[model samples]
Target: MIFAMVNVLAPIFAITLIGFVLGRSKIELHAGTLSTTVLLVATPALIFSSLTSYGVTPTMLLEMAAAAILCLSASAVLSMLTIKMFGLSMRSFLPSLMLPNSGNMGLPLVMLAFGDEGLKLGVSYFFFVALVQHSVGFSIASGSYSMSHLLKQPLIYAVAAVILVSTTGIAVPEVVLTTTEILGGMMVPAMLILLGSSLAGLTISDLRPALVVAVSRLVIGVLSALAVIWVLGLEGRVAGVVFLLSTMPTAIITYVFAQRYRPEPGQIASAVVASTLLTFGCLPFLLWFAVKVLEQS
Candidate 1:
Protein backbone atom coordinates (compact mmCIF):
# COMPACT_ATOMS: atom_id res chain seq x y z
CA MET A 1 0.00 0.00 0.00
CA ILE A 2 2.77 2.39 0.90
CA PHE A 3 4.62 1.58 -2.31
CA ALA A 4 1.46 2.10 -4.33
CA MET A 5 0.81 5.39 -2.58
CA VAL A 6 4.32 6.61 -3.23
CA ASN A 7 4.20 5.53 -6.86
CA VAL A 8 1.04 7.49 -7.44
CA LEU A 9 1.89 10.62 -5.49
CA ALA A 10 5.60 11.01 -6.27
CA PRO A 11 5.27 12.08 -9.89
CA ILE A 12 2.47 14.49 -9.11
CA PHE A 13 4.39 16.25 -6.36
CA ALA A 14 7.64 16.12 -8.28
CA ILE A 15 6.29 17.80 -11.41
CA THR A 16 4.48 20.38 -9.33
CA LEU A 17 7.71 21.15 -7.52
CA ILE A 18 9.48 21.55 -10.83
CA GLY A 19 6.85 24.00 -12.06
CA PHE A 20 7.18 25.92 -8.80
CA VAL A 21 10.93 26.21 -9.19
CA LEU A 22 10.63 27.32 -12.79
CA GLY A 23 8.11 29.99 -11.93
CA ARG A 24 10.15 31.26 -9.00
CA SER A 25 13.24 31.46 -11.23
CA LYS A 26 11.38 34.08 -13.29
CA ILE A 27 10.95 31.77 -16.26
CA GLU A 28 8.78 32.97 -19.15
CA LEU A 29 6.25 30.16 -18.99
CA HIS A 30 2.68 31.46 -19.09
CA ALA A 31 0.53 30.03 -16.30
CA GLY A 32 -2.76 30.87 -18.02
CA THR A 33 -1.74 29.30 -21.32
CA LEU A 34 -0.39 26.20 -19.62
CA SER A 35 -3.53 25.86 -17.57
CA THR A 36 -5.70 26.32 -20.67
CA THR A 37 -3.80 23.59 -22.50
CA VAL A 38 -4.41 21.15 -19.68
CA LEU A 39 -8.09 21.94 -19.35
CA LEU A 40 -8.91 22.22 -23.04
CA VAL A 41 -6.75 19.53 -24.54
CA ALA A 42 -4.89 17.13 -22.26
CA THR A 43 -7.51 16.64 -19.56
CA PRO A 44 -10.39 16.05 -21.96
CA ALA A 45 -8.46 13.40 -23.79
CA LEU A 46 -7.53 11.76 -20.52
CA ILE A 47 -11.13 11.78 -19.39
CA PHE A 48 -12.40 10.34 -22.67
CA SER A 49 -9.81 7.59 -22.74
CA SER A 50 -10.24 6.62 -19.12
CA LEU A 51 -14.03 6.45 -19.33
CA THR A 52 -14.11 4.57 -22.61
CA SER A 53 -11.71 1.90 -21.43
CA TYR A 54 -12.99 1.45 -17.87
CA GLY A 55 -16.03 -0.75 -18.78
CA VAL A 56 -18.20 0.78 -16.11
CA THR A 57 -21.54 -0.86 -15.37
CA PRO A 58 -24.76 1.07 -15.43
CA THR A 59 -25.37 0.39 -11.74
CA MET A 60 -21.91 1.55 -10.79
CA LEU A 61 -22.27 4.69 -12.89
CA LEU A 62 -25.60 5.48 -11.30
CA GLU A 63 -24.24 4.94 -7.80
CA MET A 64 -21.24 7.12 -8.48
CA ALA A 65 -23.40 9.86 -9.97
CA ALA A 66 -25.66 9.75 -6.92
CA ALA A 67 -22.73 9.88 -4.56
CA ALA A 68 -21.19 12.78 -6.43
CA ILE A 69 -24.41 14.74 -6.35
CA LEU A 70 -24.86 14.03 -2.65
CA CYS A 71 -21.34 15.07 -1.75
CA LEU A 72 -21.42 18.30 -3.75
CA SER A 73 -24.84 19.21 -2.40
CA ALA A 74 -23.56 18.86 1.10
CA SER A 75 -20.53 20.95 0.28
CA ALA A 76 -22.67 23.63 -1.30
CA VAL A 77 -24.91 23.87 1.73
CA LEU A 78 -21.97 24.06 4.06
CA SER A 79 -20.34 26.70 1.93
CA MET A 80 -23.45 28.82 2.06
CA LEU A 81 -23.56 28.47 5.81
CA THR A 82 -19.92 29.40 6.09
CA ILE A 83 -20.42 32.45 3.94
CA LYS A 84 -23.26 33.55 6.14
CA MET A 85 -21.34 32.86 9.32
CA PHE A 86 -18.36 34.84 8.14
CA GLY A 87 -20.58 37.62 6.80
CA LEU A 88 -18.53 37.74 3.62
CA SER A 89 -19.92 39.67 0.70
CA MET A 90 -21.26 37.85 -2.36
CA ARG A 91 -18.24 38.89 -4.36
CA SER A 92 -15.84 37.10 -2.05
CA PHE A 93 -18.10 34.36 -0.72
CA LEU A 94 -18.54 32.28 -3.88
CA PRO A 95 -14.88 31.81 -4.76
CA SER A 96 -13.85 31.11 -1.19
CA LEU A 97 -16.58 28.56 -0.53
CA MET A 98 -17.86 26.86 -3.69
CA LEU A 99 -15.03 25.07 -5.49
CA PRO A 100 -12.75 22.16 -4.61
CA ASN A 101 -9.79 20.95 -6.69
CA SER A 102 -11.00 17.46 -7.40
CA GLY A 103 -9.36 17.04 -10.77
CA ASN A 104 -5.62 17.66 -10.82
CA MET A 105 -5.13 16.65 -7.17
CA GLY A 106 -8.18 14.61 -6.19
CA LEU A 107 -8.40 12.38 -9.27
CA PRO A 108 -4.73 11.39 -9.15
CA LEU A 109 -4.99 10.54 -5.46
CA VAL A 110 -8.04 8.39 -6.17
CA MET A 111 -6.27 6.50 -8.93
CA LEU A 112 -3.30 5.92 -6.64
CA ALA A 113 -5.40 4.71 -3.73
CA PHE A 114 -8.02 2.67 -5.60
CA GLY A 115 -6.60 1.93 -9.05
CA ASP A 116 -8.89 1.55 -12.11
CA GLU A 117 -12.10 1.04 -10.15
CA GLY A 118 -11.41 4.17 -8.22
CA LEU A 119 -10.59 5.96 -11.44
CA LYS A 120 -14.02 5.16 -12.80
CA LEU A 121 -15.66 6.51 -9.71
CA GLY A 122 -13.41 9.55 -9.82
CA VAL A 123 -14.43 10.19 -13.41
CA SER A 124 -18.10 10.10 -12.54
CA TYR A 125 -17.54 12.28 -9.52
CA PHE A 126 -15.54 14.66 -11.66
CA PHE A 127 -18.41 14.97 -14.13
CA PHE A 128 -20.98 15.65 -11.47
CA VAL A 129 -18.72 18.13 -9.74
CA ALA A 130 -17.91 19.84 -13.00
CA LEU A 131 -21.59 20.08 -13.80
CA VAL A 132 -22.43 21.55 -10.43
CA GLN A 133 -19.37 23.76 -10.49
CA HIS A 134 -20.31 25.24 -13.81
CA SER A 135 -23.84 25.91 -12.68
CA VAL A 136 -23.99 26.50 -8.94
CA GLY A 137 -20.26 26.53 -8.46
CA PHE A 138 -19.92 29.17 -11.15
CA SER A 139 -22.67 31.24 -9.64
CA ILE A 140 -20.81 31.19 -6.35
CA ALA A 141 -17.42 31.82 -7.85
CA SER A 142 -18.60 34.54 -10.19
CA GLY A 143 -21.47 36.02 -8.17
CA SER A 144 -23.97 35.07 -10.91
CA TYR A 145 -24.77 31.91 -12.78
CA SER A 146 -24.31 31.78 -16.52
CA MET A 147 -25.64 29.00 -18.69
CA SER A 148 -23.04 29.80 -21.32
CA HIS A 149 -20.19 29.13 -18.94
CA LEU A 150 -21.62 25.76 -17.94
CA LEU A 151 -21.99 24.71 -21.56
CA LYS A 152 -18.39 25.55 -22.39
CA GLN A 153 -16.54 23.17 -20.00
CA PRO A 154 -14.29 20.65 -21.74
CA LEU A 155 -15.11 17.94 -19.23
CA ILE A 156 -18.76 18.32 -20.13
CA TYR A 157 -17.98 17.52 -23.73
CA ALA A 158 -15.79 14.62 -22.69
CA VAL A 159 -18.46 13.21 -20.43
CA ALA A 160 -21.06 13.51 -23.13
CA ALA A 161 -18.83 11.68 -25.58
CA VAL A 162 -18.01 8.98 -23.07
CA ILE A 163 -21.66 8.45 -22.30
CA LEU A 164 -22.56 8.34 -25.95
CA VAL A 165 -19.93 5.74 -26.68
CA SER A 166 -20.78 3.82 -23.54
CA THR A 167 -24.48 3.59 -24.33
CA THR A 168 -23.88 2.65 -27.93
CA GLY A 169 -21.30 -0.03 -27.06
CA ILE A 170 -19.06 1.38 -29.74
CA ALA A 171 -15.33 0.99 -29.45
CA VAL A 172 -13.04 3.95 -30.04
CA PRO A 173 -10.72 3.33 -32.97
CA GLU A 174 -7.20 2.29 -32.04
CA VAL A 175 -5.66 5.21 -33.91
CA VAL A 176 -7.91 7.72 -32.21
CA LEU A 177 -7.42 6.08 -28.83
CA THR A 178 -3.67 6.11 -29.27
CA THR A 179 -3.68 9.77 -30.18
CA THR A 180 -5.82 10.66 -27.16
CA GLU A 181 -3.61 8.56 -24.93
CA ILE A 182 -0.56 10.50 -25.99
CA LEU A 183 -2.25 13.79 -25.25
CA GLY A 184 -3.87 12.57 -22.06
CA GLY A 185 -0.58 11.26 -20.81
CA MET A 186 0.67 14.82 -20.58
CA MET A 187 -2.09 15.79 -18.09
CA VAL A 188 -0.66 14.82 -14.74
CA PRO A 189 2.87 16.09 -15.23
CA ALA A 190 1.67 19.28 -16.86
CA MET A 191 -0.86 19.87 -14.10
CA LEU A 192 1.74 19.28 -11.43
CA ILE A 193 4.10 21.74 -13.06
CA LEU A 194 1.32 24.30 -13.18
CA LEU A 195 0.57 23.67 -9.54
CA GLY A 196 4.22 24.25 -8.69
CA SER A 197 4.30 27.46 -10.70
CA SER A 198 1.16 28.65 -8.97
CA LEU A 199 2.63 27.82 -5.58
CA ALA A 200 5.84 29.69 -6.30
CA GLY A 201 3.83 32.87 -5.95
CA LEU A 202 2.60 31.99 -2.47
CA THR A 203 3.59 34.13 0.53
CA ILE A 204 3.22 34.17 4.30
CA SER A 205 -0.02 36.16 4.11
CA ASP A 206 -1.53 33.33 2.08
CA LEU A 207 -1.28 30.91 5.00
CA ARG A 208 -4.15 32.14 7.14
CA PRO A 209 -6.92 31.94 4.53
CA ALA A 210 -5.45 28.73 3.25
CA LEU A 211 -5.67 27.32 6.74
CA VAL A 212 -9.28 28.37 6.98
CA VAL A 213 -10.23 26.73 3.69
CA ALA A 214 -8.22 23.60 4.50
CA VAL A 215 -9.89 23.10 7.84
CA SER A 216 -13.28 23.77 6.36
CA ARG A 217 -12.75 21.24 3.58
CA LEU A 218 -11.36 18.57 5.89
CA VAL A 219 -14.00 18.83 8.59
CA ILE A 220 -17.01 19.30 6.36
CA GLY A 221 -15.97 16.92 3.61
CA VAL A 222 -15.04 14.07 5.96
CA LEU A 223 -18.13 14.36 8.08
CA SER A 224 -20.34 14.46 5.02
CA ALA A 225 -18.72 11.32 3.62
CA LEU A 226 -19.12 9.52 6.92
CA ALA A 227 -22.76 10.46 7.11
CA VAL A 228 -23.38 9.29 3.55
CA ILE A 229 -21.54 6.03 4.13
CA TRP A 230 -23.51 5.36 7.28
CA VAL A 231 -26.82 6.26 5.79
CA LEU A 232 -26.37 4.57 2.43
CA GLY A 233 -24.19 1.64 3.49
CA LEU A 234 -21.45 2.30 0.94
CA GLU A 235 -18.53 -0.09 1.45
CA GLY A 236 -15.16 -1.15 0.19
CA ARG A 237 -13.45 1.00 -2.42
CA VAL A 238 -16.50 3.11 -3.09
CA ALA A 239 -16.52 4.35 0.46
CA GLY A 240 -12.83 5.03 0.25
CA VAL A 241 -13.25 7.01 -2.98
CA VAL A 242 -16.01 9.11 -1.50
CA PHE A 243 -14.00 10.04 1.56
CA LEU A 244 -10.83 10.96 -0.32
CA LEU A 245 -12.51 12.99 -3.05
CA SER A 246 -14.56 14.87 -0.51
CA THR A 247 -11.40 16.07 1.15
CA MET A 248 -9.64 17.39 -1.94
CA PRO A 249 -8.25 20.90 -1.80
CA THR A 250 -9.83 23.89 -3.45
CA ALA A 251 -9.18 23.61 -7.20
CA ILE A 252 -7.07 26.01 -9.29
CA ILE A 253 -10.21 26.77 -11.32
CA THR A 254 -11.56 28.41 -8.22
CA TYR A 255 -8.57 30.69 -8.25
CA VAL A 256 -9.04 31.43 -11.94
CA PHE A 257 -12.65 32.38 -11.48
CA ALA A 258 -11.77 34.43 -8.43
CA GLN A 259 -9.14 36.32 -10.34
CA ARG A 260 -11.60 36.95 -13.14
CA TYR A 261 -14.59 37.97 -11.07
CA ARG A 262 -14.32 37.70 -7.31
CA PRO A 263 -13.06 40.40 -5.00
CA GLU A 264 -10.81 38.06 -3.01
CA PRO A 265 -8.37 36.53 -5.45
CA GLY A 266 -5.56 36.63 -2.93
CA GLN A 267 -7.67 34.89 -0.30
CA ILE A 268 -8.88 32.27 -2.74
CA ALA A 269 -5.35 31.63 -4.01
CA SER A 270 -4.18 31.24 -0.44
CA ALA A 271 -6.97 28.75 0.18
CA VAL A 272 -6.02 26.70 -2.88
CA VAL A 273 -2.36 26.53 -1.82
CA ALA A 274 -3.10 25.81 1.83
CA SER A 275 -5.65 23.11 1.10
CA THR A 276 -3.42 21.41 -1.46
CA LEU A 277 -0.39 21.32 0.86
CA LEU A 278 -2.50 19.98 3.71
CA THR A 279 -3.92 17.21 1.46
CA PHE A 280 -0.46 15.61 1.23
CA GLY A 281 -0.68 14.74 4.93
CA CYS A 282 -4.45 14.39 5.18
CA LEU A 283 -4.96 12.00 2.23
CA PRO A 284 -2.70 9.18 3.42
CA PHE A 285 -4.12 9.21 6.92
CA LEU A 286 -7.67 9.28 5.57
CA LEU A 287 -6.96 6.37 3.26
CA TRP A 288 -5.53 4.29 6.09
CA PHE A 289 -8.48 5.06 8.34
CA ALA A 290 -11.04 4.26 5.65
CA VAL A 291 -9.31 0.99 4.84
CA LYS A 292 -9.27 -0.01 8.47
CA VAL A 293 -12.95 0.72 8.81
CA LEU A 294 -13.76 -1.25 5.68
CA GLU A 295 -11.73 -4.20 6.96
CA GLN A 296 -13.63 -4.35 10.24
CA SER A 297 -16.90 -4.18 8.38
Candidate 2:
Protein backbone atom coordinates (compact mmCIF):
# COMPACT_ATOMS: atom_id res chain seq x y z
CA MET A 1 0.00 0.00 0.00
CA ILE A 2 2.77 2.41 0.89
CA PHE A 3 4.69 1.63 -2.28
CA ALA A 4 1.64 2.00 -4.51
CA MET A 5 0.64 5.28 -2.91
CA VAL A 6 4.10 6.71 -3.32
CA ASN A 7 4.28 5.58 -6.94
CA VAL A 8 0.98 7.29 -7.70
CA LEU A 9 1.88 10.48 -5.85
CA ALA A 10 5.47 10.84 -7.02
CA PRO A 11 4.70 12.00 -10.54
CA ILE A 12 2.14 14.51 -9.38
CA PHE A 13 4.55 15.97 -6.82
CA ALA A 14 7.39 15.93 -9.33
CA ILE A 15 5.55 18.30 -11.65
CA THR A 16 4.48 20.53 -8.79
CA LEU A 17 7.99 20.60 -7.36
CA ILE A 18 9.38 21.64 -10.75
CA GLY A 19 7.01 24.60 -10.73
CA PHE A 20 7.99 25.40 -7.15
CA VAL A 21 11.68 25.36 -8.09
CA LEU A 22 11.05 27.57 -11.08
CA GLY A 23 8.94 29.90 -8.99
CA ARG A 24 11.68 30.25 -6.39
CA SER A 25 14.31 30.95 -9.03
CA LYS A 26 14.78 33.95 -11.34
CA ILE A 27 12.25 32.65 -13.88
CA GLU A 28 9.53 35.09 -14.81
CA LEU A 29 6.16 33.57 -15.58
CA HIS A 30 3.12 35.47 -16.76
CA ALA A 31 0.85 34.20 -13.98
CA GLY A 32 -2.20 36.16 -15.09
CA THR A 33 -1.98 34.83 -18.62
CA LEU A 34 -1.44 31.27 -17.46
CA SER A 35 -4.32 31.53 -15.02
CA THR A 36 -6.60 33.00 -17.69
CA THR A 37 -5.74 30.28 -20.18
CA VAL A 38 -6.36 27.52 -17.64
CA LEU A 39 -9.63 28.91 -16.33
CA LEU A 40 -11.06 30.16 -19.63
CA VAL A 41 -9.64 27.74 -22.15
CA ALA A 42 -8.17 24.54 -20.76
CA THR A 43 -10.67 23.93 -17.98
CA PRO A 44 -13.78 24.45 -20.08
CA ALA A 45 -12.36 22.39 -22.86
CA LEU A 46 -11.57 19.62 -20.39
CA ILE A 47 -15.06 19.79 -18.91
CA PHE A 48 -16.74 19.59 -22.27
CA SER A 49 -14.67 16.68 -23.46
CA SER A 50 -15.03 14.73 -20.23
CA LEU A 51 -18.78 15.21 -20.04
CA THR A 52 -19.25 14.27 -23.68
CA SER A 53 -17.08 11.20 -23.41
CA TYR A 54 -18.24 7.62 -23.05
CA GLY A 55 -18.81 5.88 -19.66
CA VAL A 56 -20.30 9.01 -18.12
CA THR A 57 -23.94 8.57 -17.23
CA PRO A 58 -26.52 11.04 -16.04
CA THR A 59 -26.91 9.14 -12.79
CA MET A 60 -23.21 9.29 -12.08
CA LEU A 61 -23.06 12.99 -12.90
CA LEU A 62 -26.07 13.68 -10.71
CA GLU A 63 -24.61 11.81 -7.74
CA MET A 64 -21.29 13.61 -8.11
CA ALA A 65 -22.97 17.00 -8.34
CA ALA A 66 -25.12 16.30 -5.31
CA ALA A 67 -22.12 15.22 -3.27
CA ALA A 68 -20.15 18.32 -4.25
CA ILE A 69 -22.98 20.75 -3.46
CA LEU A 70 -23.67 19.15 -0.13
CA CYS A 71 -20.00 19.14 0.75
CA LEU A 72 -19.53 22.79 -0.20
CA SER A 73 -22.67 23.90 1.61
CA ALA A 74 -21.73 21.93 4.69
CA SER A 75 -18.27 23.45 4.65
CA ALA A 76 -19.72 26.94 4.43
CA VAL A 77 -22.06 26.37 7.37
CA LEU A 78 -19.35 24.79 9.47
CA SER A 79 -16.99 27.62 8.71
CA MET A 80 -19.59 30.15 9.80
CA LEU A 81 -20.14 28.32 13.05
CA THR A 82 -16.40 28.10 13.67
CA ILE A 83 -15.94 31.79 13.03
CA LYS A 84 -18.75 32.64 15.42
CA MET A 85 -17.66 30.26 18.13
CA PHE A 86 -14.00 31.24 18.01
CA GLY A 87 -14.66 34.94 17.50
CA LEU A 88 -12.83 34.88 14.19
CA SER A 89 -13.54 37.54 11.63
CA MET A 90 -15.92 36.45 8.92
CA ARG A 91 -14.32 38.51 6.17
CA SER A 92 -10.92 36.96 6.57
CA PHE A 93 -11.65 33.32 7.44
CA LEU A 94 -14.91 32.23 5.86
CA PRO A 95 -13.75 32.48 2.26
CA SER A 96 -10.61 30.51 2.93
CA LEU A 97 -12.43 27.65 4.60
CA MET A 98 -15.31 27.63 2.13
CA LEU A 99 -13.30 27.05 -1.04
CA PRO A 100 -10.96 24.13 -1.77
CA ASN A 101 -8.40 23.79 -4.56
CA SER A 102 -10.28 20.93 -6.17
CA GLY A 103 -9.48 21.92 -9.72
CA ASN A 104 -5.73 22.24 -9.63
CA MET A 105 -4.98 19.56 -7.07
CA GLY A 106 -8.09 17.41 -6.82
CA LEU A 107 -8.57 16.73 -10.51
CA PRO A 108 -5.04 15.59 -11.29
CA LEU A 109 -4.82 13.44 -8.16
CA VAL A 110 -8.13 11.74 -8.96
CA MET A 111 -7.09 11.09 -12.54
CA LEU A 112 -3.79 9.62 -11.46
CA ALA A 113 -5.14 7.54 -8.60
CA PHE A 114 -8.60 6.59 -9.77
CA GLY A 115 -8.26 6.54 -13.58
CA ASP A 116 -10.81 7.55 -16.27
CA GLU A 117 -13.97 6.90 -14.30
CA GLY A 118 -12.57 8.90 -11.43
CA LEU A 119 -11.63 11.76 -13.76
CA LYS A 120 -15.16 11.79 -15.11
CA LEU A 121 -16.57 12.17 -11.63
CA GLY A 122 -13.86 14.65 -10.65
CA VAL A 123 -14.69 16.85 -13.64
CA SER A 124 -18.37 16.76 -12.79
CA TYR A 125 -17.69 17.72 -9.17
CA PHE A 126 -15.22 20.42 -10.26
CA PHE A 127 -17.79 21.89 -12.66
CA PHE A 128 -20.17 22.56 -9.80
CA VAL A 129 -17.31 23.70 -7.53
CA ALA A 130 -16.23 26.31 -10.08
CA LEU A 131 -19.82 27.38 -10.45
CA VAL A 132 -20.21 27.84 -6.70
CA GLN A 133 -16.88 29.68 -6.54
CA HIS A 134 -17.83 32.12 -9.27
CA SER A 135 -21.37 32.69 -8.07
CA VAL A 136 -21.76 32.24 -4.33
CA GLY A 137 -18.08 32.52 -3.46
CA PHE A 138 -17.49 35.65 -5.45
CA SER A 139 -20.57 37.16 -3.91
CA ILE A 140 -19.33 36.45 -0.41
CA ALA A 141 -15.88 37.87 -1.14
CA SER A 142 -17.04 40.97 -3.06
CA GLY A 143 -20.22 41.53 -0.97
CA SER A 144 -22.21 41.79 -4.18
CA TYR A 145 -23.25 39.42 -6.89
CA SER A 146 -23.06 40.27 -10.55
CA MET A 147 -25.20 38.23 -12.90
CA SER A 148 -23.40 39.56 -15.93
CA HIS A 149 -20.02 38.17 -14.94
CA LEU A 150 -21.43 34.74 -14.15
CA LEU A 151 -23.30 34.68 -17.42
CA LYS A 152 -20.19 35.80 -19.28
CA GLN A 153 -18.12 32.77 -18.26
CA PRO A 154 -17.53 30.29 -21.09
CA LEU A 155 -17.56 27.48 -18.51
CA ILE A 156 -21.25 27.95 -17.79
CA TYR A 157 -22.10 27.90 -21.46
CA ALA A 158 -19.83 24.95 -22.07
CA VAL A 159 -21.38 22.94 -19.25
CA ALA A 160 -24.92 23.75 -20.34
CA ALA A 161 -24.28 22.97 -24.00
CA VAL A 162 -22.36 19.79 -23.27
CA ILE A 163 -24.97 18.40 -20.90
CA LEU A 164 -27.74 19.20 -23.36
CA VAL A 165 -25.97 17.49 -26.23
CA SER A 166 -24.82 14.56 -24.12
CA THR A 167 -28.28 13.83 -22.74
CA THR A 168 -29.92 14.21 -26.13
CA GLY A 169 -27.62 11.63 -27.72
CA ILE A 170 -26.34 14.13 -30.23
CA ALA A 171 -22.99 13.23 -31.63
CA VAL A 172 -20.30 15.90 -31.78
CA PRO A 173 -18.20 16.23 -34.92
CA GLU A 174 -14.95 14.25 -34.93
CA VAL A 175 -12.75 17.27 -35.67
CA VAL A 176 -14.22 19.38 -32.90
CA LEU A 177 -14.15 16.46 -30.48
CA THR A 178 -10.51 15.70 -31.21
CA THR A 179 -9.51 19.33 -30.81
CA THR A 180 -11.24 19.58 -27.46
CA GLU A 181 -9.53 16.43 -26.21
CA ILE A 182 -6.12 17.72 -27.28
CA LEU A 183 -6.68 21.03 -25.57
CA GLY A 184 -8.28 19.51 -22.53
CA GLY A 185 -5.27 17.26 -22.09
CA MET A 186 -3.30 20.32 -21.09
CA MET A 187 -5.45 21.09 -18.07
CA VAL A 188 -3.86 18.83 -15.43
CA PRO A 189 -0.17 19.61 -15.84
CA ALA A 190 -0.88 23.28 -16.34
CA MET A 191 -2.91 23.39 -13.13
CA LEU A 192 -0.24 21.54 -11.15
CA ILE A 193 2.40 24.02 -12.29
CA LEU A 194 0.14 26.96 -11.54
CA LEU A 195 -0.50 25.60 -8.05
CA GLY A 196 3.21 25.34 -7.36
CA SER A 197 3.85 28.83 -8.70
CA SER A 198 1.00 30.24 -6.67
CA LEU A 199 2.45 28.66 -3.54
CA ALA A 200 5.82 30.12 -4.45
CA GLY A 201 4.37 33.62 -4.24
CA LEU A 202 3.03 33.05 -0.72
CA THR A 203 4.91 33.57 2.58
CA ILE A 204 4.21 32.55 6.15
CA SER A 205 4.40 35.79 8.11
CA ASP A 206 2.41 34.63 11.15
CA LEU A 207 2.15 31.01 12.25
CA ARG A 208 -0.53 31.05 14.93
CA PRO A 209 -3.56 32.15 12.92
CA ALA A 210 -2.30 30.21 9.96
CA LEU A 211 -2.06 26.98 11.93
CA VAL A 212 -5.44 27.46 13.55
CA VAL A 213 -7.20 28.11 10.25
CA ALA A 214 -5.37 25.37 8.37
CA VAL A 215 -6.05 22.72 11.00
CA SER A 216 -9.66 23.74 11.46
CA ARG A 217 -10.28 23.92 7.74
CA LEU A 218 -8.95 20.43 7.15
CA VAL A 219 -10.73 18.92 10.13
CA ILE A 220 -14.11 20.51 9.55
CA GLY A 221 -13.97 20.09 5.80
CA VAL A 222 -13.24 16.38 6.03
CA LEU A 223 -15.90 15.86 8.67
CA SER A 224 -18.42 17.65 6.46
CA ALA A 225 -17.59 15.50 3.46
CA LEU A 226 -17.82 12.33 5.50
CA ALA A 227 -21.23 13.37 6.79
CA VAL A 228 -22.41 14.13 3.28
CA ILE A 229 -21.15 10.81 2.00
CA TRP A 230 -23.04 9.00 4.75
CA VAL A 231 -26.25 10.95 4.13
CA LEU A 232 -26.00 10.54 0.36
CA GLY A 233 -24.74 6.92 0.48
CA LEU A 234 -22.01 7.50 -2.10
CA GLU A 235 -19.35 4.79 -2.49
CA GLY A 236 -16.50 3.44 -4.59
CA ARG A 237 -14.74 6.00 -6.79
CA VAL A 238 -17.40 8.60 -6.09
CA ALA A 239 -16.84 8.35 -2.37
CA GLY A 240 -13.09 8.45 -2.88
CA VAL A 241 -13.27 11.65 -4.92
CA VAL A 242 -15.43 13.37 -2.34
CA PHE A 243 -13.06 12.43 0.47
CA LEU A 244 -9.99 13.50 -1.53
CA LEU A 245 -11.46 16.87 -2.52
CA SER A 246 -12.47 17.58 1.03
CA THR A 247 -8.85 17.19 2.12
CA MET A 248 -7.42 19.72 -0.37
CA PRO A 249 -5.55 22.71 1.04
CA THR A 250 -7.05 26.15 1.29
CA ALA A 251 -7.15 27.55 -2.23
CA ILE A 252 -4.70 30.26 -3.36
CA ILE A 253 -7.73 32.08 -4.73
CA THR A 254 -8.73 32.66 -1.12
CA TYR A 255 -5.68 34.90 -0.73
CA VAL A 256 -6.61 36.76 -3.91
CA PHE A 257 -10.10 37.39 -2.62
CA ALA A 258 -8.70 38.34 0.78
CA GLN A 259 -6.37 40.86 -0.80
CA ARG A 260 -9.33 42.58 -2.35
CA TYR A 261 -11.87 42.59 0.46
CA ARG A 262 -10.23 41.74 3.78
CA PRO A 263 -7.41 43.46 5.66
CA GLU A 264 -5.44 40.29 6.49
CA PRO A 265 -4.06 39.06 3.20
CA GLY A 266 -0.82 38.20 4.95
CA GLN A 267 -2.46 35.75 7.34
CA ILE A 268 -4.50 34.24 4.54
CA ALA A 269 -1.31 33.78 2.56
CA SER A 270 0.24 32.02 5.51
CA ALA A 271 -2.73 29.72 5.86
CA VAL A 272 -2.64 28.90 2.18
CA VAL A 273 1.00 27.89 2.28
CA ALA A 274 0.72 26.13 5.62
CA SER A 275 -2.35 24.16 4.62
CA THR A 276 -0.78 23.14 1.32
CA LEU A 277 2.39 22.02 3.07
CA LEU A 278 0.26 20.02 5.51
CA THR A 279 -1.03 18.03 2.55
CA PHE A 280 2.34 16.33 2.11
CA GLY A 281 1.96 14.73 5.54
CA CYS A 282 -1.79 14.13 5.34
CA LEU A 283 -2.41 12.99 1.75
CA PRO A 284 -0.72 9.61 1.87
CA PHE A 285 -2.81 8.43 4.78
CA LEU A 286 -5.99 9.93 3.31
CA LEU A 287 -5.38 8.26 -0.03
CA TRP A 288 -4.75 4.93 1.58
CA PHE A 289 -7.82 5.27 3.72
CA ALA A 290 -10.00 6.13 0.72
CA VAL A 291 -8.82 3.12 -1.22
CA LYS A 292 -9.33 0.81 1.73
CA VAL A 293 -12.81 2.13 2.42
CA LEU A 294 -13.83 1.87 -1.21
CA GLU A 295 -12.56 -1.67 -1.41
CA GLN A 296 -14.45 -2.64 1.72
CA SER A 297 -17.61 -0.96 0.56
Candidate number achieving the greatest lDDT relative to the actual structure: 2
Task: Point out where model 1 deviates above 4 Å.
Answer: 1-4, 204-208, 295-297
Candidate models: Cα lDDT each: 0.74, 0.84
Across 46-89, the per-residue lDDT of candidate 2 in tens digits comes to 88888887546678778888988899889999989888887877
Taking every candidate in turn, the Cα RMSD to the unseen true structure, in Å, is: 2.3, 1.3
TM-score of each: 0.90, 0.96
Hey, what RMSD does candidate 2 come out at?
1.3
lDDT of 2: 0.84
Clashing pairs in 2: none
